[model samples]
Target: MELSRRIKSLPRYLFAELDRKKQALRQQGRELIDLSIGDPDLPTPQGIIDKMSEEIRDPRNHRYPDYEGLLEFREAVASWYWRRFGVSLDPSTEVMALIGSKEGIAHLPLAFVDPGDYVFVPDPGYPVYRASTILSGGIPYTLPLREERGFLPDLRDVPSEVAARAKVLFLNYPNNPTGATATREFFREAVAFAREYDLIVCHDAAYSELYFESPPPSFLSVEGAKDVGVEFHSLSKTFRMTGWRIGFVVGNAAVLSGLGRVKTNVDSGVFNAIQRTSIWVLQGNMDGEVEGWRQELRRRRDVMVEGLRSLGFKVEPPKATFYLWLKVPEGYTSRDFAERLLEAGVVVTPGVGFGEWGEGYVRMALTVTEGQLREALRRLREVKL
Candidate 1:
């Protein structure tokens, strides 16, 4: 009756820890303003819902689906990539639908990582990146994201030996926790680095649709990007379809073939009905609706950032993503500051929970109403830290 080493190795999951604190506060009968996890509070679009409801009525969707995905769904994914990023993908060979971007991300390492192999991962990154490496018995080499560097990983700092030993390099933009976006030049540099090292590049572009000012650029938009990497896009954030759990990976045919092989062995693909609905979502022109979402998010971001600044906390409005990364005041650790805020009835994620490099900051997701955000700011006014 021994627990597996893999399970034992994991620290408490980020959101779970926040939930525990929240429950403790609730038991104490405290009114709480939670801004912790990035789960959007927005409603899914009517068009997507209507499509799903229609599909669900047909018994054809009740059966098991193709392990790779429906061809039409893959085709829709290809079309979206072309329209959004100007990147062309062959649906037959280059696209594999995912249960969600998180599923694809967690399972990708298992496809390629060998026991004891090294992976180039960003510290202060999505927890699943490091967790997946560890679950696959691979070592995660930390690439710290510092604010002065615009929170981008410094690929040059990687030792040649590490690069030679690494099997994959995982990147994300607009990044979660950090809310930093990568540029075309940075993605080009990344592709060159991956080429030199002969490794897989897993680019998570889940937040690409939630940009504030302009649409975020896709890694595949960079020249030769598809030669060395795969880009993961989500239907979740883009269309407020988080619970729908549909996304797709596109790029190098060989890389996708391996990932698809792994997926086929693991489980059946996303529900056929869901895939049909996703096709509907992708086929439609989403700019107007998505732009409305961006404008609302921008409004919320301004409220949160401006309020934090007025409270004497230094922070900048993020250009992409729905997160606001705030530096902890002098003499306060990330957890300490976050804990103080929790005690004061405001819940936010501690940056240190992201990784060692995140020691001096906290992350607040703008997934709440403007009134709730304003109220959270009012709650924060109690903490002098």
Candidate 2:
């Protein structure tokens, strides 16, 4: 059977390919320490689990959910945003629940991009931004996030003609892979750029709550930002609720309406029981619990950073997110270095899997236990790299 053009055009997902390599090593009797994916090792907070346990038993939640999610959940989201980022949102128009932020991000291009229209995507970014743009028949214009510039895209470098032709701008702070955080000043610059180009900004703030020092600012917190774009947030990293598939997008009401329209036809909304539990968690006092999780992640980050530094790989401890983006050693390409690590029973993601510009780096996720990280370090110490 002939595959659909879109399906044929897609590259195998980065993690899926990594899983294949991991399985091959496991088959060889290697007990690998995987640092390839950023899935949290910690369990979801017990309060959220108990809330879900209670909500799931109610038969009322056994049917189709509201297309935009329950009003209570949306309100809870708005409340959480106000409390967390000091950004105001209208529950009815400015907020919409997603099965996960990935779901929302993948569908966003379909809402605004046309065939051949441009999408400004950061190179070395979350792969979904580029992949989804392709699926929607959009052209993804690469915006390299160089380390010298703190991994933030240079808006000034975007050519005038490209900006004129672009439809959407995707930005992720506390970025995946790089773990770079954005400041309000940088967001202000982005908001200005989007306004000039008449483009919709889609800020993937999934890692907003995972910081080590100062909290990251929301794009919507900048003046007139809500006039230009939306922010997609997930509970996955913040609460270690990756399995829950609960997240939301908030900002310009019209932009959200367009995304909501696409969602209504393509899929059912998030599970009602999960939505209920999300509401409970959003409204409940869980700051201390979340902070405790942050502390543990910080501990793991220090261990990985120190271990890598000892081996002569100069890696900075990221300000947020559980990832360490390190440059490959002198004689090795990203993939070659990754292959070397895999041979030593340590799995890491090759940066080139993210994009052409990611060629010289490899991203190591700090999602394993400290003991596992130490073991991975021990394994690395034996490799002659």
Candidate 3:
């Protein structure tokens, strides 16, 4: 009863491990105000729910969906890209629906990376990027992200040997854990680097619609970007449809086809009803509703930033995404700080869970209600930093 070697190399999932600790504390009758995971506390908009209900009753939808996706859904995704980022996509060959952006990202490595190939990933990034690479039997080369560089890695710093063997580079802007956004100039440099190194760029733009200032640039927005990059978008964050499991990938035709090949073999498609609802969401029918959610998140971000600062933690307000990445107080490891915070009835994620470079930070998710956030802050204030 031996496990696969790939499965054996995987580290324990941070959130799952944290949940065990949280459950233990809750069993002791401690009221835990969890801010660890970035799941939105808000309800799905009525429009989206109503759309799903309507589709579910239509008997035709009971059949398995197209392996690519419903044509209407793909068209809506193409239209959204053109309107939002000026990136034109052909629904026929350049777009494919995903169960979620994470599903697409995780499966893509299997499409492009062979065993023993290298996949460059950002340290202090979402763990799935590295985990997926490892699961696909590709070696992961961590590119350290530091605050001194605005949390963006400098590609020039990568050793020539690593770049030579690399097949894919994973990047996320309006980044999770750190909440850092990339600029157009930065993306231009990345595009140039990828061209020189002959690597495919996998850009995770799940938070594109959640920004506070300027909209984050998509990899497809750059000139000639489609030649070497693929971008993934999700309805989870933007439309508050995390449970719906709908997203899309658009960019290089070859890459999209590679992902499609893997998908056809592994999945039927997203549920027809969910794809129908996603069409409405992407077509701006839900814009007002989504905007309202954004405003609420913006307010929560302000509250959390101010509250943490008042408690003597140097917290920077995130420009995008509903996360606050704060340095752990002096003399405490990120995991130790997270554990202490949990003991204080506030559940935050340890930065080390993201990567070794994340060791000195803690990520606080503003996914709870304003009242819950205030209480969590109050409890945090009582703890000595």
Model 3 per-residue lDDT tens digits across residues 308-363: 88887787788999999999989999988998898799998899999999999999
- How accurate locally, in lDDT, is each candidate? 0.89, 0.92, 0.90
| Residue 164 in model 3: lDDT | 88
Residue 86 in model 2: shift from native, Å? 0.9
Top-down lDDT ranking: 2, 3, 1
lDDT of 1 at 184: 97
lDDT of 2 by residue, 1-385 (tens): 9989987777676556556777898998889988987889878888888888999999988899987999999999999999988999999999999999999999999988999999999999999999999999999999999999999999999899999999999999989879999989999999899999999999999999999999999999999999999999999989899988989999999999999989999989999999998898888567888899899999999998999999998888999998999999988988888989998999989999888778899999988999999999999999997
Model 1 per-residue lDDT tens digits across residues 222-305? 999999999888988878888988888899998888888789899799999999988887887556778788889999999999
Instruction: Give the residue spans of candidate 3 off by over 4 A.
Output: 14-19
Name the 10 consecutive residues with the lowest summed lDDT in model 2: 10-19
Instruction: Assess the local accuracy of residue 18 in candidate 3 as a C-alpha lDDT between 0 and 100.
Output: 68
TM-score between candidate 1 and the true structure = 0.97
Top candidate on lDDT is: 2
Candidate with better lDDT, 1 vs 2: 2
Q: Model 2: what TM-score? A: 0.97
* Displacement of the residue 217 alpha carbon in candidate 1, Å: 1.0
TM-score of each: 0.97, 0.97, 0.98
Show the colliding residue pairs in model 3.
Answer: none
How far out, in Å, is residue 218 in model 1? 0.8
